[model samples]
Target: MTKKYAIIDTGGKQLRVEPGRFYDIHPFTSMGLNFLKPNTKISLCRVLLICEGSNINLGHPWIRNAIVRGRVLHPCFDKKKIIAKIDSKHKTRKELGYRQNLIRFIVDSIWSNGKELVS
Candidate 1:
């Protein structure tokens, strides 16, 4: 049977997630990372909508009780890289560096279409 699914918004982006799948999410600061602890059960409360069979449900603000659960697989940072620029025009110059602390998760299950499927 074709499984039903939902799309959720986290960290300002949309993710098409399914159970048993591992995916990366946007990085967060150390202080803000508490919300994404490893092995933590998080319900994606900001569901944009859901699809089951041929039926679709869209939320104005967010889907009510539309929960997608996932476990944090790991919390880590991406490789760092230098961002630099130099211009001889009026001696303009700029340099910067950045690294992102991303969260990896394994979707455990999704509750929708009046049912739950574990992956």
Candidate 2:
């Protein structure tokens, strides 16, 4: 049998998702502290497409009755990345480091056409 999956759009990116899988996604970190807590349930209704077995449902932008649900596993910052700049004539160099926060989500289920699929 063919595997069931769905494509979702979030944070300006698209992701292929299956049930019961965990993914790390950009949280669009804000200036202040985030209010999302661990184990909290989250729903993403921006499903772009859904594929079940050999059947495919496409949406102009987003499917009307498709939704993907997940649990917030954690919200944390990834490893720091460094940015450096060097000036030859000035003989000066500078370096900066930054960490971007990300959200960890474990997909719980996917619903399409009023039917739910849980992996």
Best by lDDT: 2
Lowest lDDT block of 10, candidate 1:
27-36
lDDT by residue (1-119, candidate 1, tens digit) is 66677788888899887778888887543336777677976667788877776778898867887788888888877889889899998798899999887888888887865568432
Listed in order, each prediction's TM-score against the native is 0.75, 0.88
Q: Whole-model Cα lDDT per candidate?
A: 0.77, 0.85
Error of 2 at 85 (Å): 0.8
- Model 1 earns a TM-score of 0.75
TM-score of candidate 2 relative to the true fold: 0.88
Question: Per-residue alpha-carbon lDDT of model 2 for 1-119, expressed as tens digits?
Answer: 57889999977899999998898888743422266678888788999999888789999999998999898888878899999999999999999999987888899899987889643
Model 1's number of clashes is 0
Name the candidate that leads on TM-score: 2
Q: Find the 10 residues in a row with the least total lDDT in model 2.
A: 27-36
